[model samples]
Target: MLNRCIATDAGSFATQYWGRQPLLSPSGSLPRDFSDLLSGPMVDELIAERGVRAPFIRMASHGDLLARDCYLGPAGFGAEMPDQVDSAKVLAQFAAGATIVLQGLHRLWPPLIDFVREMVADIGHPAQANAYITPPTSRGFDPHYDVHDVFVLQVQGEKRWLVHEPVHQDPLTTQPWTDHRAAITERVREDAAIDRVLAPGDSLYLPRGWIHSAEALDNTSIHLTIGVAPLTVLDVVHAVVDTLATVGEFRTSLPMGIDPTDRGSMAAIATKVMAEVTDTVQHRATDISEGSATRLSQRHAQRTRPVAVRPLESLAAAEHAGFHPVEWRRGLVAHVDHHADRVVLRLPDRTITFPALCSPALDALHHGLVADATSLPGLDQDDAAVLIRRLLREAVVIPAKQPEHPTRTSRG
Candidate 1:
């Protein structure tokens, strides 16, 4: 997605100012045009014909957001509370100089979906995409900073953008720009770090808390802003805190009838608690297999959506409507737990257990290599097929390319 969004190499950007300073890419170096992902007609079709709903699309003008009820109303009688987008009303507002904001396009639009997935795969961070369509000579929002880092890609026309230095550096999600609205407005007027006219194909990277606002110039303008909410140390701390719940001292209630006004009692309790905390942290540092930080990372990986899956039509074409020629999916790992009688494979979506005898075959497949149903070494064709089929059903594996007759690659 940074194909056109950055002029310099991504490695250099990460090294110098990934989350520290502003960077601008002049564009036109892209192998292919980026505007093909969205256009005027596409926006029209989404609002007028696609029946998009609230929270997905919002309209703003002169810093005030139009309420959802203003453009959406009830439809289909007989106890059905379904709401439909009022296209005519929205179009009228747009013509009247309102800016249209398409929210969560990473989940709703196909092109952005692919882009976001690739970004997550590459950067290991959750990302979302939104597009802003502003009318000529109009500003959509008042000057403000975002709580997340954003990659601004100008797709159509031109937008005059004023980017100011951050009032609060690296603001958290809980820290809204509104918290320092006065400070931000004051700073935006004093001096700007970057004030440029972003034309089609141009792109800019702004770290969180950098105040910004834009106005369409000469003609209608559209831009895609890809927001990245990078995982922070606070997140890892939270995960660890969650695991601390298992500790006895952490779970214990405060001293019975402890006076809220008594500092003596509080200090006594705190000292005891500190010892427990210190000891627990020391142990956690020594062995982190069951620690919160490791668990949090594992949980994150388990919750990630599969980047690819067999097509519906392909499934229907396979024998018995089952996916064939499968392999382990990327961004996934099968966690194993051994029991006396069976071994369990924990997947992102589900868990499965098989007789302990199959552990060797399971380990073979878990070597981070692609394989077909016939690849299991010890099992006969029928047993291997059954095992592979069950694994596919649980989404533990995916269809693989030919030559894996089973294919293979060294575990990285």
Candidate 2:
């Protein structure tokens, strides 16, 4: 899908420009259908038919946000008035030259969710999406910088953008335009690092802290800004501090008499803290070890949107079909470990422990090498079918139409 949106290979875009420099892959260079991610009709459906609410959808003109009441009204139905958007009013506002911002469409829109989910898995980081629908010749924001990296894809019409080099390089998520507005405003007046009019299919990548501004051209403009949140050293520091809480000496109280306000006293306190941190820093990798890996994988698993599980239907199918063929669900991993007495399958939702005798069958499934329940070792065909049905009930696996690759199975 990235390649569908991008003009070049996904690997090249990632290796050459990601987090390092701005990339402008112009129109024709991109796939012809790149703009299909979102369009005017879909936006209409989301606003008019779906009954979208505030914060999720907002309107702005020259950087000032319009009052919610201007575009949203009382729901004629059961939902709160404040939570319902007045589609008519919003369209009127748009006609009057306001830029409509559709926030977090990756979560709200199905296609975007699938696309962003793939990117998150590919990049090993968090990614979010937002869309901007600006009237012809209108601007929505100030000449400011974002705290996260952005990939701006022009879906419709055109937007002329002026981008300046960062005033502060690689700013953290905590450091936003508000932190240094005066400096940022002064910098945008200076020459920009990149400036161009982005028509449909044009894509631009802006690293965090790159000052920029955009205005719709002769026609209504729609663009998607995919934000990639940077994981800073501060996150690792926080993780280490969490680790230091287990150390008794580090947890002990600071100097009793020193004033926290005094520079000399603060210096002494800082020095002691630094010494302890230095001692802890050497083992930071160990502190974050396999536990960190497990936590990350678990988060990815949890990030997967829930799917409908009709276990009763699956059970009925298995009974009629003889044996069920199971496949691993998308964005899921089953970390299987065996002990003397049990087999542990640590899943995204929960852990399952089965008797050690079932290890061969479980191991085969873990490696995606088993699909047919009848092929599992250590279990009679009937028992194997029963186990497979139970796993379907738990949503540990989905029914597969065909069998998987072969792997060594244990003799029972």
Candidate 3:
């Protein structure tokens, strides 16, 4: 997925352009156009039939965002949802040159959902998709930067993009483009780094903090922006600090009678605390490292979701457990923690434990190698069937398919 958008391989993209610079792939350079992901008819269907609500849809005209009241109203009668998108209002706004923004399409649109999931796996970061539909000769936003890196996919028509260097490089989520408004305005007057019209099948990769803006050219333009939020060094530091909460010394109050406003007193306290923290970190290095790793992994797991599972189908599979092939759930995050007498399967939302004898089988499953009960390592036929059933019930694996012939089970 990352290769589809860039001219180079994934390794080159990471080292050369991932968060360092922008890369523009003109039309025909990409594998294909993005109409399968989104289109003008699809946009109309989302507005008129999907019952989309506020925050998911937004409108902007001439660099100013239109209020929700201008485009949202009641769903009428049975639904009665006051925030449902009013298609009539949207038409009115769009006809007047407002650009329509479909935010979080990865959660709302099926094609984008799958596309973004693959993208996340490819880029090793949390990702989301949003589509922008702008009328001919209209601009939706002023030149600005996003805190997260973005890959722009031109789905339809053409859009002239103007890209400039950042005023403040690699801004965090809390630091928005608005914080550097004066510098950004001043910087855009200079020669742009890139000024090109992106047509269908074109793509542009912009690292976080690169200033850019787009204006539709001659016709309505639709493009999908895939935003990638990469974890930073500060995130690791935060996890390490969280580990410090387990240390009693870190929980102690500040020195008594220290003047809060005195630089000398504050410096003394800071020095003492820093020394204590460094000593603790050195002595409890293993424990702190393990705790920090767990915290970071759990946080990443929470930010992503596994592929959707069908409840009724899963229940049926569980109740009728057989020697059918079972595959690991897509995007499922699992950790195998071994104990003296048991093995724990740690997931993002919960944990499951099995007897120590099941360790080999669990490890096989964790690595996505378990095919069926009989194929499970170490465990006997009956125990393997039980484990498979339990995993199916727990939504850890889904039924891939049934075997052509029923294989007779043998008692251990």
Clashes of each: 1, 0, 0
Candidate 1 colliding pairs:
404-407
Q: Pick the candidate with the highest lDDT.
A: 3
**Model 2 root mean square deviation, Cα atoms:** 4.3
TM-scores, each model vs. reference: 0.86, 0.85, 0.94
Candidate 2 lDDT over 1-412, as tens digits, reads: 5655556687898898777788887876335544567999999999988878877888999899999888988888677666678998998999999999999888788888877777666666677899999999999999988888888989999999999988888888777888998898889888888889998888888888888999999999999998877666666556556656667777788768768789987998799789867866666657554555565556555545433345776666556433556655544556888899998888876898888888887766655654566677777777677667667766775666454543433111
Report the Cα RMSD per candidate: 3.4, 4.3, 3.9
lDDT of 1 by residue, 1-412 (tens): 5545677787887888678998988765464356777888888888877767777888999999988776676555653444566788787888999998999888677888778777766667777889999999999999999988898988889999999998899999999999998898789878788989998888899988889999999899999998888787788878777778766668877767789788998888789887877788887764433667457667677545555666562353234312256656655645777788998987655688898867777777777556554567667767777777766666666666555355575432
Residue 36 of candidate 3: its Cα lDDT? 91
Assess candidate 2 and give its lDDT.
Answer: 0.77
Question: Which residue pairs collide, candidate 3?
Answer: none
Which is the leading candidate under TM-score? 3
Writing each residue's lDDT as its tens digit, candidate 3 over 119-217 gives 888887899999999999999999999999999999999999999998998899999999999999999999999999998888999999999999999
Error of 3 at 340 (Å): 2.8
lDDT of 2 at 347: 80
TM-score of 3: 0.94
Instruction: Candidate 3: count the clashes.
Output: 0
